[model samples]
Target: MKITSIIIALSFISACRGLNMTRLRPYDLTAELMFIFEDIDQNGIMTVFEFETVFDRYDSNVDGRVTRSVYTTYICKSDPVQYELSHYLFDEYDVDGDHFLDYHDYDNFYNKMDTSADGLVVKTEFVNYWVLLFQKYENSDIHPMSTLCR
Candidate 1:
């Protein structure tokens, strides 16, 4: 099943590429990116607390963990392309390879985005990291079907 899903996703990605629609609109992607920085305190930066809230929103089962199945299910409801992309993102975030994202996983991702090591992730840092990932996946020859947007 997994392999079949991957093949289907690859086919979709390839079709999108052929149509020159491999990249999501910059404005749309940017807005979706900023949506992650939901500054509950109205601060200019995203603190760990604010970041965790975003994770919690995705923890549909309230099990204090976000599994690939749960994450993909939620994202798939909104966009099929994003549904496929979520698989890659979930793997990237699952640093411990435990197949589930817990607080530790979330914290690790937060620290990575907090490049300045100031305990907060500024919008610029967040945007730059995602842009880098998008470019990395977009140009990767080893994983032609992998892309951050489509």
Candidate 2:
């Protein structure tokens, strides 16, 4: 099942690029994966409850923390494409320069999503992050993920 999800994600990336090259409005593959991997309830939105559940799953050994290894393993199991893309995103989560993601790191991330500061991340806010990331991919070439996006 994990491999199948990766294959589908890669397919989406390739298909989107093809459409983009043709000057068409392409699909957003990252947003698709966000929904697939993070939307625990599959209700088309990631509530706080679902996000906490995912956080606990990645916090192996119930230590209330997530190391790079644990996060990489979780991404590999959830979506291989994301596993490959992890290098581009790891530093974003490893707050405090400790090379691990703890509750504080997660809180920082959630704060970024909680644009209204209402303590909740609706579907639009969550999906828009990926959308903006992909748009940034179009303007920059320094990042490895940008290369793939093109």
- Quick one: best TM-score, which candidate? 1
Name model 1 segments beyond 4 Å from true: 1-13, 16-23, 27-37, 78-81, 139-150
Candidate 1, run of 10 with poorest lDDT:
141-150
* Model 1 backbone overlap count: 0
Q: How does residue 80 of candidate 2 score in lDDT? A: 58
Q: How many angstroms is residue 124 displaced in model 1 relative to the true structure, after the best TM-score fit?
A: 0.4
| Model 2 pairs in collision | none
TM-score per model over all chains: 0.72, 0.64
lDDT of 1 by residue, 1-150 (tens): 999999999988876554222544463375345645477776668888998898898898798998877777776675554454566678888999999999899999989988999998877778777777555455333223343432
Candidate 1 yields a Cα-based lDDT of: 0.71
Q: What is the C-alpha lDDT of each candidate?
A: 0.71, 0.65
The weakest ten consecutive residues by lDDT in model 2 span 18-27
Off by over 4 Å in 2: 1-29, 41-45, 135-150
